[model samples]
Target chain A: MIEWLAARAGWPARWLLALLALIMLAGVVILAASIGEMPIPLSVTLASITNGLGITDLPLDRIQQGIVWQYRMSRALMAASCGAGLALCGTILQALLRNALAEPYVLGISAGASTGAVTVLLLGLGGGLIGMPMGAFLGALAAFALVILLAAGARSSTTRVILAGVAAAQLFNALTAWVVSTSANAEQSRSIMFWLLGSLGGVRWPDVGLAASIVILGGLICLCFARTLDAFAFGEDAAAALGVAVAPVRLILLTVTALITATMVSIVGAVGFVGLVIPHAARFLIGPGHLRLLPASVLIGANFMVLADILSRIIVPQQVLPIGVVTALFGAPAFALILYRARPST
Target chain B: MSLEGHELRWMKHQTPIVDDVTLTVQPHETLGLLGPNGSGKSSLLQLLASLRTPDTGRVRLGDMPLRHQSRRRIARRLALVEQHATTEADLCVEEVVQLGRTPHRGPLRPWQPEDERIIRQVLERVGLAGMRRRRWHTLSGGERQRVQLARAMAQQPEVLLLDEPTNHLDIQHQLDLLALIRRLALTSVIALHDLNLAAMFCDRLIVMHRGQLVAEGTPATVLTPALIHEVYGVTAVVERSPHHGRLQVHYLPDLPPA
Candidate 1:
């Protein structure tokens, strides 16, 4: 039935699907804002949003407006931005490395960011809220540089790049664990543990703004290189034959993806599975064309995170779970299903 | 495109694989390189395609030295199709062909109607229009070879370099692919293993033995049974085929121990 529809509608169906996904994303955003211990009604949320935007003259109470516009909206926007950024990073890494199993977390950028953020948190770099995110960003950049240095020695093959990412991830994970153990403060340890497991809790409007800029800029950069990414699907030599400057292009793309991944990780810890899962889901929906694959992955990723966040809010009333935990709960089963289905065939 | 390899030399791990060899290919001509295994036919092809640099000598396309040309510029003039197809992801046939336009496209440009027209024409030319949307891995070996050919064709290159293009193809596909290439009339440098097929398709044949050109001429003048026995260590009867107006070979089996 899908194939019939695809044939009859031609390429327009792709646009239609994207439109439907955008509508669904808007619904998810609205629904996410409405849920929580202090439930905000849809009408009140819309009014608060308009009032915030200076679109309506309705006189609403400031506390309710603040809760809706400042807190809920910030968290929801962070969720969407993180989702889109991570998914875009995954898509670029998968194409650049030509590996189906690649993701930002799997490649060790997340672990590196975590170790950096944890160091700041444990060492008490600053009392300011921005300390952890800033530290994480720097750490993510360091890890990215190390991976590039390791992978650059062998410019002809992708084996070194994948191995370098693996090594970096493992080393950082161990370092993070060591930092957590040696630290004396109990509160710091608890904060570190929560950060490592990932969360969308305590997000502010500034964090959302930062994440949105990084994600949109990174996604646009990736889209610019979509044709090069397509060439990479045929492997390094074929890509080179097609006139792609393999080494430089790969390095630029790796840096871009790492930067975006680090930005998202800094904002919301290391949200796993969204990067790995959403790309595969998007590929299944729209073939492996990066042009379509990218946008679809973004929409689906945003939807997935919002849904997971909503589930986190509702699953245990009066106590909100970390959004990352909810994603793992849902993503693990889906991953298992894909593995079981793929195992026999392979 | 006119390609000139001036005394090309290549070494692997300090061991010389291709000795000083010079050859020139003019536009609108097909040059076939034939040799035994490890005779550096593939290496020379790679050098010509600029995928690898020659150790000691320079290669030039027209008046521009290959070393001076950017990868994209070289790719605009020359396209290469290697024997092996290694891909980690599943891409559809048309998508693979569309990738050939990488050199012609800028970072921000969308796909134009001209690009689609070229892809369509190349796909039809290779008789792969019916399987345009099929996953690359789902195709048969012959179909994969044709798809690769289609991809190279989509490049709109002035020169095409192929390494063992017919490695996994059936006889019919082998003939069809060569016939299609012949009709394209682009300057092509192909490394072929089968002498009879090379004789039938190539305008000129360069035979290599131990990284050196042993003979260079039309097949009828260069491919005698004596040279074949010396280079290949096989006894074969050579004769002209009635159907194709080209030389054909019939190999004689080795006798039992006596």
Candidate 2:
């Protein structure tokens, strides 16, 4: 079915799929906004969002409007942005690194963020809420730089890059563990652990604005390199021969991936597996052209994350699970399935 | 455009792989690069293609130094078909061919009808029109090489650099592909192990031995038995073919000291 549409419609089929994905994304985001402890209706949720946008401005109940707009809408939007950004990062990394296993988490960007956030939280490295993200960003950059340094030595193959990432991830994770053990009291430890597992409970409007803008801007920038990424299919030398400045393109894309991953990691507290799995899912659905793959991964990832957020809220009786745990529960099995399916057929 | 290399030298681990090689190919001339294994034929092609910058020299395309030109601009004029260019991406033959259009199109520019026409023409030319949708992994090694050639042809380059492009092709495909490349009449540098094919197709031949250009001449002049013995460690009788009037290399089995 996918091949037929792609063949028949040529380039337009991707846009058509994008439109379908957009509608699906909207539906899920609305559904996410509707479900919660307060239980607002779908119509009210839609109205509240439009009212918040100052589009329709329909008269609604004060408390209901505030809850829907202020809490649920922000959370859901943040989730979508996080998902979209992480998926974009994954797609770019996989293409540039030429590895199916390449992702922000695998590259240790998320682990670096976790270590940085833990440092700020427990070691009092930074002052407040703003400090945490900045520290995480710096840490993420540090880890990425270290990986690049290690990988850029003699015979800088893709496998070497992945190995460097593993080393960085392990080092930062150990740092996080050390900080938590040395400084955190029991109460602080519990909250820190929850945050590390990933929580949307504390997100608000500013975070929504920040995440959405960053993701959209990042996605647009990446979209512009879609052809360049396609040039990399046969590897770096082929891309260079195809007129792509391989070094500059790889640097720009990897930096963009790092920034997006770090920003989302700071905002949502290290949500795992979405970046690692969503691009593969998107590739499986659509073909491997980055033009379609980028947007498809973004839309599917957005929808997946919003639904996961909904599940996280309602999975237990009167208790919200960490969003990361919910994603890993589904992501791990899907990851395994992808590995099995992608295994070499003799 | 004419392609020239001026004292091109590339070193790996302090040892020169392409040792101060210099040559030039006029526009539309097919130059053959010949060498035994590890003799730097592929390295010379890579340097000429600007995929690797020479350690101590420069390559030029027409009037401009290659390094002075942007990669995209170079790609617009020169296309390379590397030996073992494979991908893990699940792409079809058509999709792989379409990537050849990367240097021609920009991100925001819509795919032109001209681009599609070119791609279709190249695929048909490579005799893979029926297999446009065939997955890349399913194709045999020869088929992959043909697909890669089709891709390079789609670039519509003025200069083509191929590194052992006929490696896995059958005899028929080898002949046909060489004929097609010769017919294209682009300034081309093809690294080849098959001495007869190089003699049949290339306008000029340059033989490399131990990272040095040992001989550069017409195939009749260069494919001498002594040269073949010194470079390839084989005793080969080089003769003009009665059928096509090109040089043919016939190797004799090594016998114990007689």
lDDT of the candidates, in the order given? 0.83, 0.87
How does each model score on TM-score? 0.89, 0.94
- By summed lDDT, the worst window of 10 consecutive residues in model 2 chain B runs over B168-177
Candidate 2 residue lDDT tens string, B1-258? 899999999999999999989999989999999999999998898889898889899999998799767999999999999988778699999999999999999887988999999999999988899999999999987788889998998888999999998887789878888888888888999999999899999989999999999999888888899999999989889888899898899999777889
Chain A TM-score for candidate 1 is 0.89
Q: Write the per-residue lDDT of candidate 1 for residues A40-115, one digit (tens) a residue.
A: 8899888888887789978888887888888888888899998888888888888877666567887788888888
Return the top candidate by DockQ.
2
- Cα error, residue A12 of model 1, in Å, equals 4.7
Instruction: Please provide, for model 1 over B138-226, each residue's C-alpha lDDT reduced to its tens digit, 9 standing for 90 to 100.
Output: 88878888888888888899999999998878899888888888999999998999998998999998888888778888888888999
Model 2 residue A100 lDDT score: 76
Interface RMSD of each: 2.8, 2.4
TM-score of 2: 0.94
Task: List candidate 2 segments past 4 Å from native.
Answer: A1-16, A55-62, A124-130, A152-158, A343-346, B255-258
Backbone clash numbers for all candidates listed: 0, 0
